[model samples]
Each structure stands twice: as structure tokens, then as C-alpha cells.
Target: MFVVPKPLRLLAALLIVGTTSANEPIKLYMPDAPPLTLHHYVGGHGMVGDVVLTALARIGKLTHIVAEPWPRAQIRVAKGKDMLIIPLSRTPERENIYTWIAPIMELERAFFSLDEPVTSFAQARQRYRRVGVGMGTAQVGILQREGFSNEQIVQLKLGENPAHLLSLGRIDAWFTGIPEALYIWEASAYREQNLRQSPSLASTGLYLACSRDCDAQLVEQLRNAINQLEHEGVSLLLRQAYLPLQPDP
Candidate 1:
């Protein structure tokens, strides 16, 4: 029997590992959330997407982004193998469903109303007939946890503008991430109307997450890459470029 030298065996193992990593491309599911992840943005990917892409590049991992409705994107990623989802808010309800790789940014949810701002959930339930929130978003769960009834919560489908709904008096308040609310308000024709933002309802870290059974090695590599970006101030710079006036949380 012929025995391979230890150095030769180590070299062969390295070659095999490199080949596998280089060939396997991860699938990243993203929804169209402006200032975070969107197709029409200047870089063709928003702030969060850019951060994720930059991290993946640092790790030499190829990825293909799948643009889908928010609901479908979450479902597919939750069930699929080795799949990744971005800009996902980490909540107690979703804590066990996915492997949280890294926190991309902090998301502060609030109520944006054309009328008087609702500072508390109790006040909102008593005064507002309906509150608009994006379908399949963390805001929906947050409202539900706050004891908002079905009749009081209006789930806005993809492309449904809460600002427009507010103008038409469809929803009394829009419960959503502050960044998104500000972005929509600034761009919409409803700018003339005073958009009042209530105090933050909930705050959570948005993350790059993977399926429950994600590969541990991949998670470690991505996490390290993301940490390096954070250390170098790359993440902060990107965020500032998009949200210059956004207050630190």
C-alpha cells in the first residue's frame, strides 16, 4: 500500500475546500424597501444590500439576489435550504426560525399620521380606526403583540403607499420603520400634509439571516466579514450617505 505524504494530503484538502466554496453560490432574497434594499437605487442595491454584497465579496462568495414580494421572500427563505434573507428584523417571534448571521442596521418603528400622532398603543387603539403597515413586516407582528385587532390593522400590499393611503383617509396612521416613512413622505406629492411621527413603538436590529439549517462555516465567514466592515466604519459611512439626518439610536 502507498501512503500519501502529510503535506500532499493537506494540499489536496485545501484544493477541495476552495473548489467547493468557489462553486457554490448563495441565494439572497430581498424585498423592495427603499433606502435599505431596492432595485432602482444608484448602486442598483440599497444601503443594506450594499453592505451584504460587500461582506460576501470579502469572503469570496458569489451570490444571486432574488427580488420578490415581502411575504413570498420571507416564506421561501424560511423553508429553503442554504438560503439567505436581508434586512430582516430580529424579533422574538422570528428568533428561532432562521440563523441570524449579522445585524446590518437598527430599525425603529413608529406611527406616522396626518392627524395627531399616536404616542402609545392604547391611544392608537382608542382614537385611530385603522393603522397601515407593510404586509409581512415586523411592524405587523409588533402591532399584533400590542393588542391591535384585525380591523384596526391594515396590511398594505407591495407597492401600496401608506402616504397615499393617509392622503385618501384610508388609514389613520402608518406603522412602519422611520427610515421608510421619511423616504416615502419626502418623495410623495402628499408632502404638503404634515406627517407627524410618534415616539418609537419598537426597535430591533435588522439582519442578514439564513435558513435554520444553514452551514456553520458560511455563517462564520459572513459574520467575520460584516464585523470587519463595521470596524472600518464602512457600514456607518454607507448609512450616513443615505440617511444623513437620521438620529443615532
Candidate 2:
């Protein structure tokens, strides 16, 4: 029989307690939304994904992660998978749909075009023959609210590939977030062939939306974790990756 010292026994007990406390691994879904969440050559990590994983780490063990299409991710959550979706915009309609947790990140919507220059939403509405939109996304809500009928909208999965359609003249403008839109626009082969994007159109906040199946106490714990991160400037720390826009001289 092996005999352990009192201090060793106490440490062993603490380790067991800690292990038991972190029994279940939390699932997190990250869609491919560049600069914010994208799979680059270096790795499958971005500012939003990184910040979210950091925050969630404080609350629970994160695992079983997948970077899929946003619509699929939404469906998974809707089906009550034990997971968290990052950078989701919370609307009154979505409130009943998903259990609310801490806000993970924020994003501003923008329009990228290959046709004539657009100074504003109204101008883009009138000038563009077609607009690229992500199916079942908050951007769809914005365009629908602005009176863009289904016939006028070209739906695509969530990501900057919509901008490619725009550049191909398949659509006029791609509706997307500022950081992502700009990154894709700059990187687009069409831009190399001469395509351009207008300035940002609108700004919106994004949040972490958990499955409604999540326990209330768990949700509250995650929210507190987020609050702590915010208080400690975790958001500001993440901002370091987003270098300000500097025009080519």
C-alpha cells in the first residue's frame, strides 16, 4: 500500500474536485466568416472564434467544435444541440428561438459592388440590378425591411463568396460585414481584375446564442464570464488583430 502525505492527499482531492467540476465539454460552432472567423492557411482561427473560445474556456471545457455553414449551424442549435454560436445578432424574433448568453463580438454590415459606385443604401438600391444576400441571415432581415423583394435578391451561403458572384456580374452587391467584406474585396480575383466595394452600410452588434436546451444557470454563468472578460478588456485585446483600413498610397 502506498501512503501519501497530508498535503499530497489534499492536492489529490482538489485535483479530483476540479476534474469532476469540468466533466462535460461544451460545444461551439464557428462559421467561416473571415477576419472574424475563417480558415486561413496558417490555421482555422480568427478574432471572433479566438475571443469566444477564450471566454467560453473560462466557463466550461470547449470541444466538438465545427466550422460549418451558418445556416447549418443555426439548424443545429434550433435542433437543441448542446452548443454555442458566436457572433450572432440578437433580434426580437431570435429571442424566442435561442437561449441568450454573453455577446461574443460585434460587426457592421457593408455592401460590396462590382458595378457603379454606391454612396448609400438608397443609391445601391436604385443602382444595382441585383444584390447578393446570405440566406436566413440577419442581413436578409435588413434587406427585406428595406423592401427588397425575393425576386431582386440572390441568396448565397454565409461568407464572402457572395462577393465573387457580385464581381462576376452575377449580382450587383454583396451584403456582408465590414471587416469580412473589405478583406474579401481586397483579396478577390475580380479586384485584381478591377472590382470595387462601397463604404460600410450599417453596423450591428453580435452575441453568443446558446441552444434553448441549455440550462438557465449555465447560461447565466457564461454571461458572467463574458462580463468578466469585457471588464478585463478582452474585447479591446481582440481588436489588435483588426488593423484599421489604410488606403494604398
> Which structure among the candidates has the greatest lDDT?
1
Quote the RMSD, in angstroms, for model 2.
8.1
Model 2 lDDT tens row, 80-134: 7557887688875677878878766667776766555577878777776678877
State the lDDT of candidate 1 residue by residue for 34-91, as single tens digits.
Answer: 8788665544366687778767766667777788888888888888888999999998
For each candidate, what TM-score against the reference?
A: 0.87, 0.80
The list of candidate 1 runs beyond 4 A from truth reads 1-22, 244-249
User: On a 0 to 100 scale, what is the lDDT of residue 174 in model 2?
Assistant: 76
Worst 10 residues of 2 by lDDT: 1-10
lDDT of 1 at 127: 88
RMSD of each: 9.4, 8.1
